[model samples]
Target chain A: MRSSLLRAAHAPTELGMKIAFVTPRYGEEVMGGAEGAARSLAEHLVADLGHEVEIYTTCAIDHLTWADVLSPGVSQLHGVTVRRFTSAAGRDPKFSDLDARIRVAPSSRSIEDSVAWVAANGPVSESLVEALGDCDADVVAFYPYLFYMSVHGITRVRQPAVLHPAAHDEPSLYLPIFQRVFDSADAICFHTEAERSLVEPVLHTAATDQIVLGLGTGQASGSGRDGAAILGIAGRPYLVSVGRVDEQKGSTMLYEYFVEYKKRHPGPLALALVGPVSRPLPEHPDVVAAGIVNEADKWDIVAGAEVAISPSAMESFSLVVLEAWVARRAVMVNAVCGPTMEHIKASGGGLSFEGYLSFEVTLERLLGDAALREHMGEQGARYVASRYDWPVLIRRYEAFLESVVARGRRSEVKR
Target chain B: MGVDGFDLDQVRREIAAEVLARRTSGSVDAVEERRLQRLFEQYSPHAGGVGALSDALRSVDATIFIDPDVPVASSQPAGAAIKKTVRKANYWYMRWVTTQVTKALSNIAGVLHQVGSELDRINRRLDLVSNDTPAVIQLADADAWWHNRASEAVARAKGRVLVAACGDGSFVATLTALGHDAYGTDPRAEVVPTHGDSLDLRREGVIEHLDAVADAMLAGVVLTGVTEAMLPAQRTWLLRALDRVLAADGIVVLHLLKPEFLSGEARPVALELAGVEPLRPSTWVSVLHDRGFGVNLVDGGPDALIIASRGPRAN
Candidate 1:
């Protein structure tokens, strides 16, 4: 009996799903944005919908012991039940070699090694299946990529399963395994429309009915209604670009334009680029890279600016633009990416630029005219509030899970 | 000891000053407070308040007693005679001494020795309660010792429950082999393992009475050495955890380097704080007994190992 079959045999109805989140490591404070997001999502699922949630993860640096490797078992954490799977990564030399190989090329013997390692030292998929067999869940949602080996074992089980694909960057690298996973899953979820497009080729045309869950935006409050004079800008107040230092983020281009625009206009127009610069910038002072900032710091930066600028050519969804809108700051975006264009058209929040000169002019006009910035900022905030918020987004997620569970039940009935 | 170097008269004067200072203050803060507290709590006072004060003063007087420019007392009797004569002369001069000088000298020596002995006991008690043996073993000079030990231990005790005391969940990966019920506790923060589950022992007051908790449980207890010497509170909590959760019939394993032999260029700050003290076998036995645990000495040499069980109660 395969683990998935056993899991399916014991899986509950759609209304009674009890989801167990399995990860090699679990904790909100730990590394990796994906892990943090997963932890946050789990918390929301349990707190709001009364769904049972559990996270399994590794320990931090200080408290490791030998017994952890020897006796793999389940323990409770912050209302979640976590089961640790032991591996020989730290013990056997072969295991270390295998882990290294997997890092270089995930399709190599590393995948086999990981599967074998979990089967031998850590808990097998059977154990998870048996554990779930004891519980009553309508479906199991698997966060894939690193834990890909466990996916096939999970999908083959008795219950329905949903794959919440948190895809980022070029999707081609993972197309092979992702295609298999997509076919196996009863339903799929995408973080952005751009991400959804990336997987469109591999996904069947009929699967368009599958959930295209968009990345939700955060809350927005306070408007820059006091105008540009109170904001302390001397000349034509301009735009601000905020993001981490990455080549794709287009900080260099934003800087070049700012320099040119400053040369053209004598007024106190400033393009404040906040967030850390991972790469070196040319000697340009007006292009202020404020480095990494907290929420309060970002609010102050946005509140004083006439408009928010996003020059990223490949953003799945711009968290910075959402933040700017929340602060009631007018936005300027490059004509790239689906989310940015959709947001601009829907909210009439601000303007978009096809080239550098036009972007500079738009920024100058917004800074010179305080009334225009105010009007755009107010409209942007309203659009963001209605669409985002976890309360609204999570309902969509729940409905997607329900649909997956329902499809699985109907398929079983047909069989 | 020579009379000139070990002057009983001068010592006696110092003792008298200390006693007078303590009496006037109405508290024991004038002396080593921890040592004084232990003494008063442990020993039955033979003398009444005033007599105890006088005896204490007399003891100080006798410690400094010396012959005029003499190197050594001729014999034990002669040294005794000299001490008595000096105290007697002082008593006569003071005109308020009631006890015989010879008896007073004996009483003073006895009290000082008693307090010193009590301090030794407290130090030993502290060591037994807080020593993080498993952490010490994992950190032993051998590389990957934690991983190996965890695997081996789990393989050995497959069906039994394993309790990792004062462990952060890092060892959860290693202990995953044991198929046993594994739980961890740390007073500082809840260490939720990425691979396994961990209960926050702080909420259960496990940190406060770790020894009792460890002793009461029917599971094997593994203490991960988390710089026990640096953290006094963790040591206390671990000791209590071991005492409470460790099964009576179960083995309590610890891995620690003899404090004197700890390698890696010694940290001046840690040394100043932790201090260097040789771990003695007898010290281990005595300390464990004090914490309601019986000792079964295991591997030793430069690095020490011990397996202790809940010992017969003192009462």
Candidate 2:
């Protein structure tokens, strides 16, 4: 499905072209999908494609607070330069109050009120906006449009702007203000077709200048025993879920399902979750919550796991699913998520279950038949190799950015 | 032993032999050549074929949990294994052919399915707006009720009111008689009163005329029988345009024609108005709200009126 889009579009050129990426937050510690993707793309562009890439971001460590955790300075990661600026307005309770009001009592809010709400919803960096206006680059990309940084900075971007909205079925996207952001962009890049579908209706047209250029993954091929040792769950076979372990991410449903699975089929199988925990985990003996793992350990755990379960219902793109594929693990994803379902269907890499019955069936099948699991994992690995390896994917990324540059040049000529 | 007893070297040898045989027979076509080119392009980045295969196998072993007691192969750096595999797997013809055929078939099927889904989406959107209509006319009663309603509505209105899609200019005449400055705009140029020194009715597109209106100039808009005639997209445009021209407190009264009053020319006109389809009153109201309109639905048996005002977040 994605191949056709790539073939249809004009190919990009790789040279000394400079591209600047703008995001609300930027750091290795930043655990969000868009941030990670931005860092990956930025570094790869510089290292592999021989392009001059710079990142313009706020000096914030956490998205929840948008506070200046990192000192404002220019730093380099994998040859990509990252210049950070402090957000003039950080997090406030009023922004939360206004958001709640907008959700609960939409009628009470005016256009001005909504605009104010967006403003008060911090990461409102005047310096970032100024930097966008002054940036000298062939192309500037603003990511994950929910932020005040994107909403404010994207409009100010002087060069050709490509917006990676990273949008899902969320309330804030429904605001009328985002319409302008969509209109102002030179090109819109989607992480998945489902994200495109979600944005297309709001924009009133299937965007012609859009591409579903998925992110790349660094493949993991190590034993899970290393990860198992780190988590102190060395002996038992376990299925791992890697991400922020919270209820909003359907972690609660996953926990309940795992508990039920344990009861239904008694075995040495344990559910080991490794990530930052936002909510409390059940005190069940079979479940192990390994809090805040480093990248290497995370990959090791995933690599050694029996299966990878991702239960998030709202996901623009599941990096964990791609990572799981890279690790050669069959994944059990929530059937409700668009990106995960689409990925599963395209790769034939795993099974998806919407309810307890399907979940049980999928788990039973994986546990009972080792060959099927192996086959699925192999299928997924090939799919990832053919599509998402940085060596291959960087070309697509370059092509897309080049296409935007070409369009920008043409429009400039017309003017 | 290979990883999990899966011999990567044997698979590579089999592939290489198949490719060499095919090449020796001069059987590789342009399509086959392209497929092989794609395969090399995809997998050539990594160090060695065996190493790549080992990496893939490692992923598979970790993912597919079997009996740990099942003796697994000892670890090799895959450098020697990779060198042996790639050297032998140069003519891996069978795998390449299978991948190419599968990819082509999948692309074709996916394109067709996508087209079918797009058509389904359009059909579904049309269904959301389309309302059931009768075959023949019964507008005499409806026309009378609209005349009285327009008169009452205009009398209560504070400023100039525009009646969009006014069928015969009779409703505009009725509003003018009720001591209100009422102008009627209809799409059909021929529908204008021939004997007009009168400026009450004009043959103009409502959207164009509304666009020409000064911002916040109109005190009210009367769109009684037009919802059935307008496409969902056009209705959205009309509402947005109406929003631009309407005063902060301006009201729009949409007198939705009864499904029963639709017939012959009028019913077919509503159904067949290029891309326009009639929607249920409830659907229209929902659309109005989505467009930031504060709406009130007043039920009047077969005919209904939707009184809408621009909400705080109308823009």
Candidate 3:
């Protein structure tokens, strides 16, 4: 990577500095994408760069419930200090009602209504904020812009605030209260260019510095096998989709399309839904509802498939597509998904489908040609290694954080 | 190997065009699910006809382990104590039973794996059956033809140069003698030279060595012997790794075996073990060209000697 993002980060700079990440949830078991990403980044900061890192989060596991289930206290998770505070303001009963009002036209909502909506969104941990206010870390990263930990807690930190804002194109993003969230941030980190485009417009006054510092992929491992013992689709060709199987994630759409495709194509191509099943899946003979498989099995299923499909269009950055590419599996993505569409086009690793007709055509094309699939998968893998490897990301982040620290120092001098 | 010069964008365009053509042909969604699924099953990466045999073996190997430990406690107070006492009393019996079960299970699992040696011999013979082309046996040459050319090509290489498949480290010594910090890796144990340790000659294949190497660490590479031995997938991985590890100005000197060397020759055991043929030198040149490299085919004779340098796409 001659003109690499990491090239600037690799240049002479600070060696090690204390970094803190404040997220709403924290742990491997906590499957929220943003929280998991935060954990990986924090761990990499420690392991790869030898930086002192800590995580300040509410003891909340369930995103929807916002209940403080995990024991509240300082603990070591994956070699990083994770300080969990009991959720002060849990999800309010009136939160859904208030959220509904703000959901329709968030920009037009009253400041008071927006603030209430945020608080009602809950996971309001006052103790975590109080701790952050006195913390000695160089900078605190408040993850995923929608959360109270980021919106409210970012203001409480003594050090420079870096907001990761795992921001997606959603109604909650336009809330009047978020103008301050972006304004108060020292530096902003975005997941993808598409995400940056969506959120930057909402920033009336942007942060001092910002970067599309995306998430890294797990270096591909394991040989994918026939789904005989794992998914019971032994010797059967399968199309695997990894991630939560839900309506919002577009699994329903994917299922309908596959069922239609199988009818049209007249073949025994099974569809494997590999994730935590939230909604009821159909009892079709071909659909293998593998629930939530382990990471090894997930890779195994994905690698073994004729094609891997990322059905969701709601992604900020589809890490699954990168993962599939790493495993050398060709991918099919939702055409409307800006970030995933961008990835497919840029990498030429996969195809995107607008609907059933497009899906039918793309799936057939991928299934028929082994050489094309292999080429595309290799290209995707190359894209991921060049752009989103942890080493590359951590270096860019190190440089970004260093600048944030420098800016903070400058601001203090001005004061 | 067959699908040379395959372009994804071109393929996508063709697919789109076909889809459009099919749509124009008024093809309706009247296909059968059961039949389509069966056809799909055959196309699965897992079940590629005889390749399914490999999958079955992998499956057997993966599932062979029989974990012996099981929970041996009781919920009731007396029940737990009684169980513990009985467990202690029958410890020898329990150990014997577990041991026997484990042994039995292992023996069953080893039923396939035990024939590994026989399978190797069978596989070597099968390679000849599958591919009847003659192989040209190239013995290790201390004064190899490409040594001087490689030595000169990487003269100004910024960092250490790697001489892969350096049989007896002669080429590596030649480069080191020429003042280039050259190291080598060869898997053959008998080829261990007296100064192998000092020369940084690791006992592993180049691909294995490159897999663990830090990105953009190598200044130059000299590949020999093992290039033809690589499987198609391994070849792709080697290219990717070289792209990642080789510096911008890095030169790669490839001493590829002649493609005319086929399976019929009284070949080395390693050649039979490799179970593959050499890719055409032109194919390598074209691949390197496609990947944005300044390729120079120094000698496309008895054994093709190509020198390639990173081009503008060295990212």
Candidate 4:
């Protein structure tokens, strides 16, 4: 157990410690998952946890350059101090290797190019190193490690650093670089228990101290747990799948199965596929394709659903599943993904399927038995409240930071 | 002639004294005093010699020339007679002044009408410069008309395209079409991304970009109403895309709503917002110029019909 004194000392004072968050992209320009996570976490850290947090990221246009080497330059965003290094898209020698790869396979335009740009630019230039030398910050945190500027900037600063690896896929591919970065950090954080498990194999030392942080979702105050409609039945009752139309997201299987199931159930039931139609699907009046819904609309879909289906084969963690649990909707998951299975086992929120028949049978059973669905949903919501709320997750994060900082300080003293 | 009537001079003096008393006392009665003073001022100018004499006695009245040749007895008895004659003369003078004032006012009104007509002409010319050339101005007028027409058409067809062609991509985005696709082609390709999938522009290397874009396979294409102002070559490409690429049953809609006024010969610059660059109309027309499209005025007016078909046939 870490010392209570250490914990109390780390308890953020009312004055609040200054935290600089570094990312490849921040604000409204790039509306990706990492951007969403950074914004949500930053808000909670500042508003709920009593920390003054500012995010530093690169501009969409400014490719990496030697000129970005200056420390602590301010960004046009919300008065947050941002030091922008040129993007890797430009001609810089350090990124020559990654640029070679990109030239061969140019499909992944933005992310890979940015990483190469930062690597060539020597992370933060000497001038930017001098600038951060002047800043008064207790900690610098980096979110989702694509930005080389962030990795370079924080590592040189000698401040307690927290690296939150938001995604856990391609472990062997991407984890080694992160593992080294994490080793340098005072603490490491992951969003889900499943993510923590993936990293545990690499993290031989200090595995226990590294925390599994819960993602903060928007306030679900207006959501109700009961009386959602069952739209359609494939094998037994209606099951709905909501997600982007990608191969990784298994909506194709659902659509194929739903077509078969429609023949068996002669009654009026709906198997709605609500999400952005990334690819065109054949028109079916029975299947309501509510495309690209906003946040409120997404929650409404979840709340109105009897069973929320997640067939993702490659999700790091299913935010949609978490949302379904919050709405007290029955979550049906494919057991292949580490995060989905772990969440289901831990929360008892929903059923997981090992095969197609298992998914169909479980969905059928849930549909036929309303009592079982209701009880499971209740259990899920309670489990989510106990494990995933901001207060519970933020405390774990604070403790992990304290442990890291204490260990670092003790080591420094011994030396 | 009316000595039996109440003494008007005494009444005037009494009212004035009361007003002074009220004002000096600082009573709320000061409001009443002000009201009474206004009444006195309005009626004083027309008041007979009795009030005039009272004004003179108070040293507030100006003196007028009097004929000394007139006998004292005649004047004294004639005072009543004089008052009657003076009243008659005053009435005639007032009537003459009223007629002259009416004539002057009518003349002023005529001048004002001429000025107003001149201002309207100037305003119309200014509109040609300030309002007409702006793509948004013409777009808004066309869109409103298109919306009403499209709504009726959509109700009948159930599945048809509501094609809107304007330099303003954002406005085109707001139109309703069944399986709707809105195309706003411009030399500026940068603005295309902001309006999402439906908004597409013709670029310098459009053939290559189109091939790359078509590799993704869009569901439908919308050719909004075209204008003759576009360069001849670009119109040919548009026609080609329409005939070759557009599905056989796909509908092509056009808008020709004209504005009541146009801002003549005014160059309007697009305003830049955060994250979005401004694109001018000339920049938009250049797309057509490059594509070998020809625009003809459908009606004998400034309005035009943009005929979209296969590329222009060989001469």
Best by TM-score: 3
Better of 3 and 4 by DockQ: 3
Report the lDDT tens digits of candidate 3 across residue range A1-415.
Answer: 1123332553322456778899889987765378888998998988888787889998888777789889999999767989999987788988878866765557777778888888898888878878887777777888878888787777777678888887665667777778777767766787876776566545532213466767888865555555545889788889899887877787877787788777767767899998877787779998998987777787788888888998886787877888999888889987657788889887878888754555788887888889888888888888888788888788878877875675462221110
* TM-score of every candidate relative to the true structure: 0.41, 0.56, 0.57, 0.44
lDDT of 2 at A206: 32
Most lDDT-accurate candidate: 3
Give lDDT tens digits, candidate 2, residues A1-415.
Answer: 1122322342233335778999888777877568878888898988887788889998897656788989887998778888999877787767767776665333334567657777777777889888777787788898878777777777777678888988766556666666666667767788876777666655532322556778888867454446667778777789999887877677777887788678768988889887777788868988999878777788888888889999887788888998898888998887657888899877878877654545665677677778767966887898788778888778777877875775562121110
- TM-score winner between candidates 2 and 3: 3
lDDT of 1 by residue, A1-415 (tens): 1134534664433233456554444553332234445565666666667666654443321111212332357666565556654433322335545433443333333335545533332322344444544443556666533343234444454567555555443312232344445555554555554555544433331122245445455453334343233233434454677775545466665666567567766656666667756575766545556666555556666776767888765555576777788888888876544567667777767666544445544665667667767777877888778766678777767666654554452221110
Off by over 4 Å in 2: A1-15, A104-110, A221-226, A409-415, B1-315
DockQ of each: 0.00, 0.01, 0.04, 0.00
The better-scoring model by TM-score among 1 and 4 is 4
Question: How would you encode candidate 3's per-residue C-alpha lDDT over B1-315 as one tens digit per residue?
Answer: 223577666766777887677666756442332223222222122211122245345444444443333346778768877877777787777777877876786787677665765787898987654432222234447876677777777885766588777767878778867766677767665775632223445555665567545456578888886677666666787789789878878888888866675446644566677677668888999898787788888664657788888855233
Candidate 4 residue B175 Cα shift, in angstroms, is 69
Tens-place lDDT per residue, model 4, A233-346, is: 333234567666644466665665455456544566666776656566677656667666555556655677779888765566677788778888878886556788788777
Candidate 2 residue A246 Cα shift, in angstroms, is 2.7
Fnat of the models, one by one? 0.00, 0.00, 0.08, 0.00
Error of 3 at A278 (Å): 2.7
